[model samples]
Target chain A: MSSPKVEIIESYCKGCSICVEFCPTDVFEMDGFLAKVVRPEACTKCMQCELRCPDFAVKVH
Target chain B: MAFDYEQYLRPGKLPHIWCPGCGHGIVMKGLIRAMDTCGLEKNNTAIVSGIGCASRLPGYVDFNTLHTAHGRAAAFATGIKMAKPEMDVLVVGGDGDGVAIGGNHFIHACRRNIDMTYVLLNNYIYGMTGGQFSPCTPVGAKASTTPYGNPDPTFDIAKLAIGAGATFVARTTAFHATQIDKLIAAGLRHKGMAIIEVLDDCPTAYGRRNKFRSVIDMMKRLKEIAVPIKAAAHMTPEQLEGKVLTGILHQEERPEYCEQYQQVIASAQGD
Candidate 1:
């Protein structure tokens, strides 16, 4: 009964905003040119971040 | 990650080159999941691809991958299967790469009914070399090459594969993530040739030209248009128009080419 863990690989992030735009739960935010999982608690583990990230930057556990 | 994508992907190859919101990543994820579910040994699997955005997939995977020439992935994969029939061979290519320049090789591969799985990503245009019209490009759709609108007919890839004699054929879209994984696993397990056509979204190249507002818009459109094969039977032709039928379209048992060829070789040697 715990929230899904979301991790963002900074080096791989191109800050394309795909994860921010696609996540139905609004779990990510852009920090400059990189994406950060601001609301890990909101993570639904729907895999939108991981699947839509062309850079292979996001991982939702 | 809990999925262990690292085990299947080349971690050093992180930060892939696909455009933001491109559907190729979704397809890759589905393929990885399929591989995991099938319990395929990485070292024993051979991945082959022709030139295009989808073709770049093999470069990121950790298997025995060959980034072959444009439109020749199937031909190269055939050689790998012939050399070592024990190895699981998977061919990946885009619509333009697989059906346009490589159309001849594709049909022949299906006709041969070899033991291999082919994952064809149809984004409806030539994405890598600019938004050009491709064989799968929809009629009346606009592309860079087709300034006004595309006039050529589009190919129903699944029907073509079934007609060409592939033992297993299926279709799915990037929006249907879980279904993509299931279909890919089914394709891999099939004895003869299995062709899985994935309707992916090329947001930058195909979406913009086609008047799609964003990646989400394209994904929603795919969701709206996809109809399950079983459900399609109950729907009218009007309801079916513009709707892509997902799930296994055709499948049958048949003799695989490599095994037949080996038998021929043994008989000739005895003679």
Candidate 2:
């Protein structure tokens, strides 16, 4: 079964790319410098991306 | 250079930035071991820290480390958990940072019962930025700021957590390194807020002011004063004066912040 999904709200994404770089699995991809959850199912719900994001724009739910 | 914990430790940096024989490194090592035992992927873990010597831990650990502002590890950890919720969050800080300035955050985190582990390194005094007195420096201890001996009483962090609604609370010392790992691993396994206070030796500050000749002497002092909470529970007044309690002080199962948050949105959506 797939792991927990991390829904990334694109408009809220500031695109610092910290989350993209932090996730162990390539769950996130950059779309014009904004973070896109290309593989939400790949998200392990570790929250490393959310925690490290300085903007607080991204919400995993 | 070999494949041991000491091997992973930065030798060039060592002799450690902490004062000679300070217990912070021992506590850090125990934390690493606990992480190893949990089968946590190093690259997947998030370690957060705040200002203070003990808070400098995130930089030393080879993970997704966050070295944040003073006394804000819990606040930061909250954001981390709320956002991802699946990732394990470990907050590391000292008494002054975690309990005093960050005390409010600590209480709120406990009340909310967030799914995270907080390791509080209590060496009594603010050993890093100078021997200043803190909320847990104990009443009557001398510090650079409290030359006449401290007039303010100390706080028992584990007791405070129990009172504030933390689902789990435990106390241990750096000297009990293996037990420290077990406690940390247990906290990681817990579903809600788990506060582990690790008593440490600040030989340069709390020790010197309190009159210990060396770090070993300071450990001896902790040995004499520390009574396992279990043992203390059965001790008579004759055996329990001026004793520290080292064991799980409280534990309870409760709904954690993440699951409750998901419920909130689910209820709102009626889905």
Candidate 3:
């Protein structure tokens, strides 16, 4: 179990969905227009989502 | 068994700003691993970048970093290395910032054989300020600016660096994370200039236009087309179509710019 969590800065997210697709674990969800981290436990802390997000909205803690 | 990634990542900066499935993440991971392997002191390390999607790396990294003007990372890193010869300097940028807009600076850096390492995160298209075609974008590839198809020829960076006088030149795609890590680490230890071209994917810009199903599919394309030098030597022309060679293309030693500059200064008697 990866204790690390992923948090999204909704204010910065431009609805790019880059992180949602890159995360191998499907840790993110589309909350209508924003990227919502529906499952933090699923995150492996790979930082793939963070690095791939062009808008710089997603982060892995 | 846990990897202490936290030690290098800043807490408040949780999450990065890149788009999903962008290959930038993979390259960043490889760079971090390479720095760790080199046993670099964080204080003594610096990462610089120009204005491009890939140039965003310097900000995410928890090191002495500089995000400079477009296509100027090479020049920026050049000045830094010239001032502090002992610092572990790494310059990160995309094909556009590094080669297109900053083409002259790039060639000169290699020509100077300056003691620095350049990790060019080449995603083919310029993913920043819209998906424009870069100098390194392969011919016939579709980008925002190159609607329908790209008719221009691509820049073979490894060969270009070799011709430009870079002492060390290597090419690796984001798919080869471990290999890229080792190559970058080795490049940092090299005495003169080193350039590592990382073939990354711009899922948003290059990907959608090319009709690729997803980013994974784009990465899989690397395996199908990527050829090691050994394999390439045996392959015929017909078998080489669409394939790009990856690995250390060249390595040699020569008098570096800073070393020669010191000699000239000594000869001038500090005049």
Candidate 4:
């Protein structure tokens, strides 16, 4: 299977840091106020960030 | 595809009015996923809500939506279900709207065993009304209305649903994101009245006064307090103290209200 790609929609991100705090593998980091996928390779596609993000900014594929 | 949330969401309603870390958005995503899992026809599904922060959820979803008065979601949903029994009616509302202002309608609907799903988002405060203590607010919690700390006793929403005669009842927190969809999907598939109580968070209004420094802290609290039913059985009472059980709390087969009403019509017509 191909590695999952994670994307954060900047327009929708409210910088809640829920994605940042909840990612078990530390796949995200805050770039200013928006969540940035800092470690794409570590993403296990657990979907914690995408599911918990209140802003609907995170998407994994 | 990446779950295709945009397909379920209404166009141009992107930035929802909920706060950045409010758990209502998480529940909404879960509801969308549940609807998809159940293969509910968007045109045939009617989502109803009352006035509150959580009530705004119906406006964002692409469905037959109804935004009703404060605490009247269950009543409106009942009318819709009775009028068009084929439509899948779902009610969404907050703790205050569901149990406080519309408490009577909620219990009666449960008693009637209507074939509808009610997702009660218990954020513990009236978030839209500026952090007033709600029926589910924990005792001694500070709210805008209770600056000295709330003295009101809280309602165990899941127990209330079970006691009120809902056929299917479940509970989960927003921190357990995956479980939300699972419980809701189960509720959707159930034949009689299904109530899913989501222990949600209100970071802005509830958290600020309650000493939670940030949204992450509030979410962490939800994560810590929820113990799944299977795991809860293994733990001692001391270990489970202050923790809420998460899973299907009650379920039973019962004659649905609409079908029973149909029987009444048949009997009256001498069929």
Candidate 5:
């Protein structure tokens, strides 16, 4: 299977770090006040980021 | 293909008021997915919520929505369900709203076995009101009001619902993201009163004072503590202490209130 793709919508990201904190695979990193998917290879397609983001900022596929 | 969240959300409601890392969003996503999986019509579904952090959910959903008075979501939902009968009415609220001030309505609605779905978001604190301890707050947990530590015993909302005669009751946490959706869908499918108490995390309000290192830490703790009902059956009481059992806790078929009320109306009109 192909690796999962993770997208972080910068405008919706409030630097809450929920995606970084909740991602079981550590698929995200903080880039200033916004979350950046620095380790997309580790994305497990769990959609934890997409579901848990309060700002509706992340989407995983 | 991806789920088109915009298709189910109200425009200009983006950037919800929930603080960063709060679990209310996760529960909201689970509810929306449940609605999608059930193929519920937006025009036929009514979302009602009371005033609180979790109650803000109805405002974002694209449905017949009501942001009701504090602790009165269920009452409003009951009215909507009775008037429309065929409409799918869902109530969303936090622990404080559902169990504290609204506790009476919650139990009576279950007792009446009304055809409606209630999703109680139990985040342990009153998140929007600055972290006060709620009825579902774990005993001895520190809250803004209980800076020293809480003295009151906490409530088990699922058990309460079951005792109050709800036809369907279940519990799940935000960590079990997919399970949350499945349970919600099941609850919606049930014909009588259905209550799904979701253990959502309020990292800003509940976690910070409780000493969870981060949002992830709280989520991990939720996973660690949730024992599936089937698995819990084999465990000793000692092993099960302080652990929450996840899954359908109880369910039964009963004559729903709205259907029964319709019969009464028909009889009265005939007479």
Candidate 6:
């Protein structure tokens, strides 16, 4: 399997910082008011950012 | 392949009306995943809700949905289940709509042991109506209606369901996102009434008044207070103080209401 790819749908992100705060591996960072996938390589594919995100803005593939 | 949430979401319903960091959306996602896990057909499933922020959930899902009058989700779902016994019925609503205004209906439905899954999102305050202190709000928590402090005792929703005779009762927080789907899936598979109370967060309504600085703080609080049922058993009463137990709290087998009603009809017809 290849490394996981993390994406953030900017339109749906409400900038709650939930993904940034809860990611076990520091996979996301806040860019102004939105979440950005700053370190996709560190993603363990736990899906925490995708599942806990209230806005459904994060996706891991 | 990554799970496709769009397959269950209604078209053009994206950007839901919930507030920023609202936990309702997460609960909706869990419901969708549970339906998928149970292989529920959209045409054969019916989702119903009453008037509240959490009540708006049925509107976004692709299943047969009903947005009913305030505090009447259970009543409406009961009618639907009776009329179409084969259809899978699900009810979604908030603490106020489920335990306060709809308390009578809620308990009666449990007493009937009707075959339906009720996902009650307890956000403590009435978020849609501007942060009124609801029946589930903590006694000392502040809300718009309780400027000084909330004086009302909180309702333990899972206990109420179990006491009223629901066949299955479970409690989980929105922070436990993965467990939500598992519990809801279990409820869907159960043969009689199932109540799943999700401890949700309302950053805008409940948090601001309660001195939670941000949505993250509220989410962290949920994480802090929740202790899984298995872990709680090993802890002392003092250690478990102010902590809420999560996981399936109750389960039992009971004759479903619809099947009993059918027997009554057969007897009346002299069959």
Q: lDDT of all predictions, in order shown?
A: 0.91, 0.80, 0.82, 0.93, 0.90, 0.94
Tens digits of lDDT, candidate 2, B34-72 = 888897776667889989989987776677789898888
User: Candidate 2 docking: what grade?
Assistant: incorrect
Over B158-190, each residue of candidate 5 has an lDDT whose tens digit, in order, gives: 999999999999999988888999999999999
lDDT of 6 by residue, B1-271 (tens): 3578999988888788999899999999999999999999999999999999999999999999999988999999999999999999999999999999999999999999999999999999899998999999999999999999988888999989999999999999999999999999999999999999999999999999888999999998999999999999999999999999999999999999999999999999999
Question: Model 3 over residues B135-199: C-alpha lDDT tens digits?
Answer: 88788989888897899998988888899999999888876767888899989999899999998
What's the residue-level lDDT of B207 in candidate 3? 90
Candidate 1 per-residue lDDT, tens place, B61-177, comes to 999999999999999999999999999999999999998999999999999999999999999999999889999999999999998999999999999999999999999998888
User: For model 6, how does the per-residue alpha-carbon lDDT over A1-61 read when each residue is reduced to its tens digit?
Assistant: 8999998988888998999999999988889998888888898998888898887778888
Better of 2 and 6 by TM-score: 6
For residue B80, model 1's alpha carbon misses the true position, in angstroms, by 1.0
What is the DockQ for all candidates, taken in turn? 0.51, 0.01, 0.14, 0.76, 0.61, 0.74
- Worst lDDT 10-window in candidate 6 chain B: B1-10
Per-model TM against the reference: 0.94, 0.78, 0.83, 0.97, 0.95, 0.98
Please report, as a residue range, the 10-residue window in candidate 3 chain A with the lowest summed lDDT.
A50-59
Candidate 3 residues lying further than 4 Å off, grouped into runs, are: A1-61
lDDT of 2 at B238: 79
* Best-matching candidate per TM-score: 6
Every model's TM-score on chain B: 0.98, 0.95, 0.96, 0.98, 0.98, 0.99
How many steric overlaps are in each model, in order?
Answer: 0, 4, 14, 0, 0, 0
TM-score of 3: 0.83
Candidate 6, residue B151: the lDDT equals 83
Docking quality class, candidate 6: medium
TM-score for the first chain of model 6?
A: 0.95
What's the best-to-worst order under DockQ? 4, 6, 5, 1, 3, 2
